[model samples]
Target chain A: MTNEMMMLTNLNCPTCAAKLEKATQALPGMKSARVIFGAGSMNVEYDPNVLSQEKIRTLCKQMGIGVATVVPGPSSDI
Target chain B: MSRYNDWLIRNREKLVIATSGSLIVAAWLLRPLGNTFHFWAMTLAAIIAGYTVAKEAIGRLSTRQFSISLLVTIAAIGAIVIGEAWEAAAVTWLYIFGGFLEGLTLARTRSALRGLVDLMPRTAKIKRGEELVTVSAYEVKAGHVVVVLPGESIPVDGKVVAGRASVDTSSLTGEPLPAEVAVDDTVLSGTICQGGYLEVVAERVGTDTTFSQLVYLVAEAQEQKPKVQRTLDAFAQWYTPAVIMAAALVYLGSRNMHLALTFLVIGCPGALVVAAPVAVVAGLGNSAKHGILIKGGERLERIAKADVVAFDKTGTLTLGQPQVASVTGFELEEERVLSLAAAAELRSEHHLATAILSAAEKRQIEPAPADDWTIEAGLGVVAHGPDGEILVGNRRLLLSRGTDLTPEQAALMVEHEEAGETVAIIALNGQAIGLIGITDPIKPDAFGLVKALKRTGIKTTVMLTGDNPRAAQLVADQLGIDEVRAGLLPEQKVEVIRELQKTGHVVAMVGDGINDAPALAIADVSIAMGSSGTRVAMEASDIALIGDRIGQVPGAIGISRRILGVVRQNVVFAVATVLLLLAGVVLQVIHLGSGMAIHEASVLLVTLNGMRLMK
Candidate 1:
């Protein structure tokens, strides 16, 4: 499993953030997903063989969240 | 096509606002021509604005989630189904506009941390063989020589190997004064050099620097939810589903789907869900910018309710450095007695030895070499010198050596001890010679801090120390402390804290030593002072004051209290708005557009209230 963090540009509502986290976590081979509403970022841990970073970004975009930047590894700021 | 799709994705909100707004304007302009043109224009407005809301609602529904977007989508579709296209268009447009305003206001609250991140210099000047080269700050490796000119930010944590400068450290320590840095002095990243050029050997780069650690700690602190936030989240979990069920029952009972749809619109608890986290983020971020690091939301709550505060003495209340206060010689000059004591302590590694050596240095007395040095634990040191046998220790050491102390000398020793000075007896040739008084002076802000804590509603301020009772009492009296616990071992300090907790007092322990760790862990809130150099103390503390200023204690507590007040106010405001909107919907006084307008206004108000802590 690999952990990654991405800047979420339009994550405005807490309810939407919670849903985004749940949807990401429910993905196959995913460990956890945490969306920090205040910081406007999402952290996810998932198996690379099951789902790629591009697939994760696409999923978030389909849910109306804009992923501005994707960086390998969890956010050190957290 | 992909480029256009990307543009549409980036500007989705703005597109919704513009399309709906222009269609509504066209509907009004075409009203006089015919009802057909006006009706179709209003329908187009509703569909364009409702498209995204419906998409989000359906997406969440597929995942078995209920959200505010779901409520807004239901309301807009219901309005359109009832032939109220204008109401549907207005509701969705207003919701999107409110979200845009909220995003702007939320960004303002996060500006504190953003300012800190911006302070880091982007590029650094480093020496590469003969020529100087510029590189990204994060790319500067350890052991590289970085050059910092005046008015430029230091790019990495390093030691100065050449030149001198005074640097502004306000970003790190919250101290307004600029610190003068000479050769071999360590300089921190993110601080600006105010004068002179410096060549610093990088020791810590990237995230290892103090500035990065502070930013990381603050961000992590903001993410930790408080008990209040957790409770609210749990309440929201049931609230959303319950509201939808209630709306279904209302429609069945009253046979009025319009009122039921309005119920759903008002039921979205957007304001309540955001109240505490927004306040916690802004409060923690503002405090971190000022060099006070409250670990998390739980610690902030503890600091708010703290009634009694306990302070450790040595490095906390007083300057930890002890200095020789006075000297008295029985049958010789004061200078000779100090010289003998310094000579005997030249090879000793005791704390008192440093005091005596510093005192001798102040008097321009160079300590002579001594031989046959012997140490008696808990007593003093004895040595054979060129002049005679030198003895420097406590009264017990001198007495055990068969040295007789006159009544006058004993009285003077008692007097010095009562005045909060540690008395050390000096003897020569196995006879009582003189005595030296060493004292750790109280910090200049000690008294003021006590008064400030009292003003912040602290019921009692107690001083805890391992010093003699008389000395502890003397310092306590000067600081106006309510109680003094003296002669306590390290474990005894923890016992004191537990006793306070047993008595039902919310206690906060402030200390700056390894001995204070246990007590700090047991207290309701533990604060560590001078955390800039002490990683252990920072780890042990609930709150770490990077600066050694005693005044920040009250400042931190006061900030916590204000944050708590704001959080409570937001919760109350959000609940009241929900109740009022529910009542308005049942009475059929509020339509879809008006209900959404009020709902969005309430959320924005709560956000604005939380942002007040930024100051």
Candidate 2:
């Protein structure tokens, strides 16, 4: 199990924050999820054995959250 | 097909609002066709507009939570059930459009933070023996040698092991000038190595780097609500339930459904919910861009309200590096006195020691190495040389070492002290031999800072230093400070701050050394100036000015005051708009569509007002 914090886009309305949190929490292998709309960031804990950062990124992308932060590549953008 | 699906999902809110809006207009244009078709058209528009609202309400309701979405969804559905399709269409359309506007504003405020994140390099190139290997920046451990070529940003905080470069430190210090770095000079992460091949041994990697810490600090700072935000939050907690009850009472008293539904639309706490957070985010983001880190909104408030600004003289006001201004020899010639003091101070790392050694070097006086060298902390240094035990420090050192100065020597020391020159007494074998007078050059920015603070409504400006009273007074006079309290130890500085508070002044202490840490802790707000190089200074201060420039002091205060002002304006505007709309609805001057339009307009207006806080 590991915990990671990353910036998320489209958290414009504070009301959307709870919905995003619930959607993220319902994902497989996710232990907990919290989206801080004020900070425009999210902190999540999950079992890496059943989930990966890429899978988490995919989940956010599907949920229409903006670009995932901390992706490893030539450019800083994921 | 998948890409199209993704686009649709991303633009779902906008698309739904547009579709529902066009359908409502079409229903009006084609109303002459038939009553049944007209009714169906209006009902279709209502469903399209209410789709997202109902979805959101259900999602939140599943977790046993109630929100504005639930209230909006209930009101929209009730309007449709009561055969008022036009009211249903207007309510859901305005509500979703308002949400879209808020999301856009949030993106604008958070983009300031995004700029910092973009500056971070994801990967670092490290040297493993002879081969250069690319690795994640977080995986690069401390003590590993990281190499950077021309035009690349430094990936870690470390000392330069080899090569020379002029690195642009604008990102960290906000100083546009490129600093020259040779062997042994430390460099921070996020600074671009403009032109050089440098091999730096990493001292701080990943999250420990200054750039990373700044990103983390700023993100957290944006989340910190001001005192007014908390009070408004408490008011909002009771406000939602009160609005629900108000809506029910209005419908029961007048028996009018349209007027009651208008209350639900206007009483959503639309602008009030966004006013404080947007202002706080914009304010913190603006200051962070200028390399000023105000820890949070609470600290931002104290900094804004600080009436008195007390400065630590050495590094904060003066340039901190002193020069050998004049030398006096009592029992020996000046040359002999200089050589004795220089020998004992040659190996010491104190700023005054460098001055003594450099002065001796300029005069062609060679300084031999000394043994039994021990630093006496704040007092000075002691060592044994060819001329027996040599003591070099201030009067406190002499008094503590059981040496008393003659009246003539004491008079000479006062002469230099009165001239704003630091007197370092040199003694050999318990006999006072000479006093080497050194003067630290005051920063040019410090000259008009006092007047600038006054212009910012600072009630008092004070200079607190461990230097002698006469030296401290001379600096205070030059800076035109309101008060001078000198000859104080670290703990004594805290006493001064406490007394300032006792006299009903909210004091802000500015310093950059360990000696000032205690005082910085006790003040209403502590500002650490010139913190790009000092870890302790940043850690001790509530607000850290990354650049050494004293000019930022006023700029920091100006930004804080502007933030406080903007947040206050937002709160007043948010609250007033709500009360005005409520009155308009009671007088029946505004209907459902018009009230929703005015309500959403106020929400968007407050957000835009808050965005103006950004640079």
Interface RMSD, in order shown: 3.7, 4.9
Q: Report the lDDT tens digits of candidate 1 across residue range B1-615.
A: 877887787677788889888999989887998877887788888888878677767776676766677777877788778777777787777777767777676666556655666676778999988789998887889999999999999988899999999999998898899999999898898899999999999998865676766655554565677888888877776787888899999899999988888888788888897788778877877887788888888777888999999999988988889999999998999999999999999999866998999999999999898977988899999899898898888989977887767899899889887777898999888888899999998888776888899888899998888988888899888988999999999899999989989999999999995778888888899898854466567756778897777779998898888888898999999999999999989988977778878888898888888888888
The deviation in Å at residue B204 for candidate 2 is: 1.1
lDDT of 2 by residue, B132-192 (tens): 9998888999999999889889999999999999999998887888999999989989889
Every model's DockQ, to 2 decimals?
0.26, 0.33
For each model in turn, which proportion of the native inter-chain contacts is also found? 0.18, 0.36
| TM-score on 0 to 1 scale for chain A of candidate 2 | 0.79
- Write down the RMSD of all candidates, one decimal each: 4.6, 5.3
Deviation from native of the Cα of residue B612 in model 2, angstroms = 1.7
Q: Rate residue B113 of model 1 by lDDT.
A: 50
Clashing pairs in 2: none
What TM-score would candidate 1 get against the native?
Answer: 0.83
Per-residue lDDT of candidate 1, residues A1-78 (tens digit): 776656676676656788889888888988778887776767788888998888888888887788865543333333
